[model samples]
Target chain A: MKGNEVLAEAAMRAGCRFFFGYPITPQTELAAYMAKKLPTIGGTFLQAESEIAAINMVYGAAAAGARVMTSSSSPGVSLKGEGVSYMAGADCPGVIVNVQRGGPGLGGIQPSQSDYFQATRALGHGDFYMPVFAPSTVQEMADLIYDAFDLADEYRTPTMILADGMIGQMMEPVLLPPERDLSTLPAKPWATSGSRMERKHNVINSLYLSPNKLEDTNYERFERYEQIKEKHQRQELMSCDDAQIVVVAFGAASRIARTAVRDARKKGIKAGLLRPITLWPFPTKAIDELCDGGASSFLSVELNMGQMVQDVRLAVNGRASVDFYGRTGGVLPTPEEVLQAIEKVAAGEPVVQSAEPGAVGSLLPHPKHRKSSYERGE
Target chain B: MADYNHELLCVLSGFGGQGLLFAGKIMANCGLIDGRQVSWMPSYGPEMRGGTANCSVSLSDDAIGTPFITKPTALIAMNQPSVEKFAASVQPGGAIVIDTTLAMNGAEGVELADGVEVAAFKATEIAEAEGLKGLANIICLGKLWSLTNFCEREVADAAITKCVPPKRRHLLEPNLRAFQLGIDA
Candidate 1:
């Protein structure tokens, strides 16, 4: 199964009865698959007018306590940000998948990790956080879709999946998860299906008035985010315990990192990989564990110049020096290239001589120290 | 009997309808059914238009990296342009099954520098002959079985059977026979 199909299957298993999406490359097949499969299992699938409508439809169904989802590419995701902020303010729970393709515009429909900043940082708005899960494989797609729902509902926040077109279109054997028994799940308290006399009408609203009132609401959401960062940070570590080099990545980028690590190992350089499954609750703990005693050197690898690198530096917090490697404009670096970079760092050479920042695709610099636990990339 | 620890396949040129994508999917699923790690990826971007489409399907005993086949060990060509574009990229001594009915006319028609050429004419012919030309992709896949030693009969046969509709079960024998003809033709 491909990641998009796995995502659809995972949603069905999670009791998602509603999926609304518009057609876009890389992600179009996802919506098409859902259109076919959702109806077979007595679920509702809709092809909305635009990404705006699709995202808002997700918000509407999520308000009804249904496990709902919508998906789009990078540009479409940028359009859906308004709905995302509205969903966040409403405290609705659902999954939004961005099977990201290239660029700041319709750059290309090929796979890319450039959407990291858009997904992790607030894309649409005022102080808020939407948990982001990044899956690199078909099995991870199913696994993280389930995880996205659980965390979204538990925290009463929207959860986003930041995966690239490669992950979305690529096929792999996915270990289909056993269905979750929705019967065992407790009923949500704020669903608005017009309860009639059973209960009073529940309104799902994101509108807040007065500066202090909005601030309180924001604080409460942050409180939940803090809990999430503390408890919901997800990561994967490969051969890092006794490693001299640590390469950090997530989603499709992580899969490439794995190949580099293997090459590094073959060349006698102890290169390790740390992959974050959840980009929002950026797995700082794992990085800290790797860097604690100056035992591991760090390198942040992403498709974009350095979106995720900022998070890596934050995770290490000057406990260890950090370096960067990247490729952009829909071009992904091969594992051979990444391994070469790792070898250079291992040889005490600045593998990356300089990462030029442009007006459009500027290389993100190492940020200054900020007194915070983590920015939590989603 | 076809079996290997590593199998890499490239399927090219989309917009020829979904036939190529379907073929790659069957192979990938078959590899998985045979208990192997498999990766299948199709070409996107301008390659889907008035151009050739390419997809890579890989099967290995070990984990796979980069689903996109930068270089391939096995290939299946269903159209003339597909044959022309992908034939040159096949690994030396690797197997390439071409749909001769549409692609192979003469030695000048194929551009491959190396690899054994197995003319695959029966796929569309047999399917069209049997009034099921839509199964041409699978027929070619069956024919390629003789050329591909990575996946075994038991697994590929079962995968093909399961992937088809129950209503189409009556067409199974013809597909199986067409595949055999391609392998030996």
Candidate 2:
């Protein structure tokens, strides 16, 4: 199955009974796939009036403790931010899959990591936090969709499977979770399913008028956020130890960052890559661990100008000054450009990275091919 | 045969009738058949008309991130603009297969750089001359296999055969013939 199809399947496995989303570039297939498949599998799939209505529908469904989900590209996601805030304020447990497209506003439907700040910092109004998972490949996109559901329920907060246009668009070999394990999840205790005599009419709302009441609610949510950060600050460090340089990125950017490491190391630079699976709760601990002079300097790369670069800098905290490299306006930075940046970081030169290259290798692979040079240590 | 769960990234582009998207789906299905992580996203929105249309396909051992490629590791460019738009974006040391017949002005859009490996072939003309006007994608895929050695050749054949509409399955042999001809051409 396609990654989007797997997402639908994973949502089903997680007990999601409803999905509402408006079609947008790069993510329309996900909705189209769900629309056809959900009904047959006894689920609700709605092509809402707009992203607004879709997210609100998700909000309503999630309030009833139903496993619900909604997905959109960048612009559509921005429109749904208000609903995301409402979900967060109500402490609703649901998954919002942002198959991100490049954008400030109406950016072209190309894969980009521009939405990193938006996803990690919480895109909506007032102070709230939404955990965002940035998958580098299709398999993670599917599995994380399932995990997103569990995390949302565990914290009673909204979670986003923050994918870029690439993950949503690419095809990869991903295994389906065995059916048996998928059927073993626990029932939700908070769903408003026709409240029984033991429980009263439950209301899930963001509005708490009294300052004390609001503060109490916010504090409780904050406590949950703290617990989430402490427990689920997940990240994957690739070839980081005993390296002379480090490249940090998330989402599709992380993939290129790994490629850059291989290419750089081929040039005799001891470079490593650090891919943060979770964009929020920012993997500062793993990032700081590289400060043991494993790399004399660190290079922060992202599809955007330098949002996460700030986080990397903070993690390094002047222990070894960090460098920034990026591409904007929906353009992606290639590993070659990334390698150039790494060389600059290695040599203490100013940044001069560009998204231009001359040639490429053959596209088809041999039967006994290795997945990557790094894995093969070539 | 290639541990089907392995990730594959392919981008095919050309004029509308080139079957770029359909071919990408076939490749995607190869992974799906093996229960591998997969996604196929085709480029549209203004680029679908007479302009450039490309489909991004990725098959991997693990779940994939954005299916779109800002810098693809491998590509099959069948038009001038398609080549121009994506050449510079190719990952350094990545493979790019260009249909020389269609991409007449080679590297017009690409800046001079090291690392990216480029191979130009007469895929379109060869297919047409061989009476397979619709097999340009196959020819490109054949060249892709020759260059990267990324996927088993049999899987590509199997994927294409599986994706060809049933009513059109009668043409399956011609398609495979075209793929083989392109591979050895």
Predicted model with the maximum DockQ: 1
The interface root mean square deviation of candidate 1 comes to 1.0
Please state the error at residue A19 of candidate 1 in Å.
Answer: 1.9
For all candidates, state DockQ relative to the true structure.
0.66, 0.30
lDDT of each: 0.78, 0.78
Lowest lDDT sum, 10 consecutive residues, model 1 chain A, at A353-362
Superposed model 2: Cα runs more than 4 Å off: A180-183, A292-296, A353-378, B1-11, B24-45, B55-136, B139-156, B165-174, B177-185
**Model 2 chain A lDDT-worst window of ten:** A358-367
Instruction: Name model 1 segments beyond 4 Å from true.
Output: A193-203, A293-295, A352-378, B1-3, B9-15, B46-50, B104-143
Clashing pairs in 1: A120-A377, A120-A378, B3-B149, B11-B55, B12-B53, B12-B54, B13-B52, B13-B53, B13-B54, B14-B53
RMSD of 1: 6.3
Mind giving the per-residue lDDT tens digits that candidate 1 earns over A1-378? 678888888888887889999988888878888999899988999999999999999988988898899999899999899999999998999889999887988888888888888888977887887889999888999988888888888989999988899999888888888888888555798888778788888888988778888888889999999999999888888988788789988877788889889988988888888889889889999888887745457888888877888898888888886888877777777787688778767887675522332212323432332224466443
